[model samples]
Target: MRALKLVGKTLNFEVESLGIIEWYIHAIISYQIINYEVLPADTKTPIEVIIDQLSSLSLSIDSKNLVSKNYFQKMKEDKLRKIYPYFLKMLNNPSLSLSLSLSLSLSSLQTIKIIIILDIQIFIKLMKYLKI
Candidate 1:
């Protein structure tokens, strides 16, 4: 019974650590989006790289630990389930626009527009999934 309790405590710690990591990732992404204009040009790529690394690490962890795999998978699914409505509302609200009309180059504007459209598409797909 002591061994079992030890296992339980370790699993709980791992799960909580994963949650903290995920929360930090989300917070960083949100901060970048909100402060895009002031961010350095190289900022976005590094964040993407970190996220990709984290994703691969998570996948490896999942493959090695069945319990953690199940927990993380459910966590991801639950986040997706809850995100669509909030995302749709953000897209629909003009006040929440990320546009910066501060004489940005045409290429920059185009990039921003493309990113926004892609996000909208993903959110729309999520909405459809929820409806089904």
Candidate 2:
């Protein structure tokens, strides 16, 4: 999870946004697969605060829920549904972390499907910017 920590550190997201997403990710990770001890820490523990924050973020992501707070609240209770399916696939197969991350990074060259896509464009830009 050291890698996740580094990535989290480098991310330029706002503090509030970071706090929100990090919590849900941690809780889902802890609940479905592993706990924080086995992974990296980006924000809080006990994880409830983060889970609570998720309700707000969901409103922005899913417009239909924007009308009522209850819609987003419901999503928070069902954490697994919020996790992108492709990400879970990657989590299920540990050997694919590098390959999956690399593929996500090259999304412009190839259409990404059936895989959880995250940070691909940002990764590509960072690599070029750093001359790596």
Candidate 3:
């Protein structure tokens, strides 16, 4: 209960991307509930206590990976790897397609118009191709 409340409180209610956030939250909660149910009652542990233990056991990745490539580069790669599976899962959700389709329509048109508008010579050449 305490862990659940903590997770709930950490959620940014004002953020515009609630659907993505909720997807992660529900995924985490489901994982926790399923694991807890499988564990024997005598062996069960509070989520906070488990988290605290894990925090204490945290190990830093090798500094060599950071020095040559920079920390942000490694961190970015790690974040992409972690989220890639979840992103694929989200792609399977039907409602998400609607938002993606709407975004793609504007993006594709905007990209073409930008290239034409930004290059007047190119626009004129294209018009000649059309005999306009």
Superposed by TM-score, candidate 3 places the C-alpha of residue 71 at a distance from the truth, in angstroms, of: 16
In terms of lDDT, model 3 sits at 0.32
Give model 3 RMSD, 1 decimal. Answer: 18.6
TM-score of each: 0.19, 0.22, 0.19
Over 1-132, each residue of candidate 3 has an lDDT whose tens digit, in order, gives: 344234334541111221221233235334445533322221244434333332332122442221232322344333434323323223434343333111112343452222101134433453454344
Off by over 4 Å in 2: 11-116
User: lDDT per prediction?
Assistant: 0.33, 0.38, 0.32
| Residue 97 lDDT, candidate 2, scale 0-100 | 32
TM-score, candidate number 2: 0.22
lDDT of 2 at 75: 52
Candidate 2 contains a number of clashing pairs equal to 2
Which regions of candidate 3 deviate over 4 angstroms? 1-75, 96-132
Q: Number of backbone collisions per candidate, in order?
A: 0, 2, 0
How much is the lDDT of residue 122 in candidate 1? Answer: 41
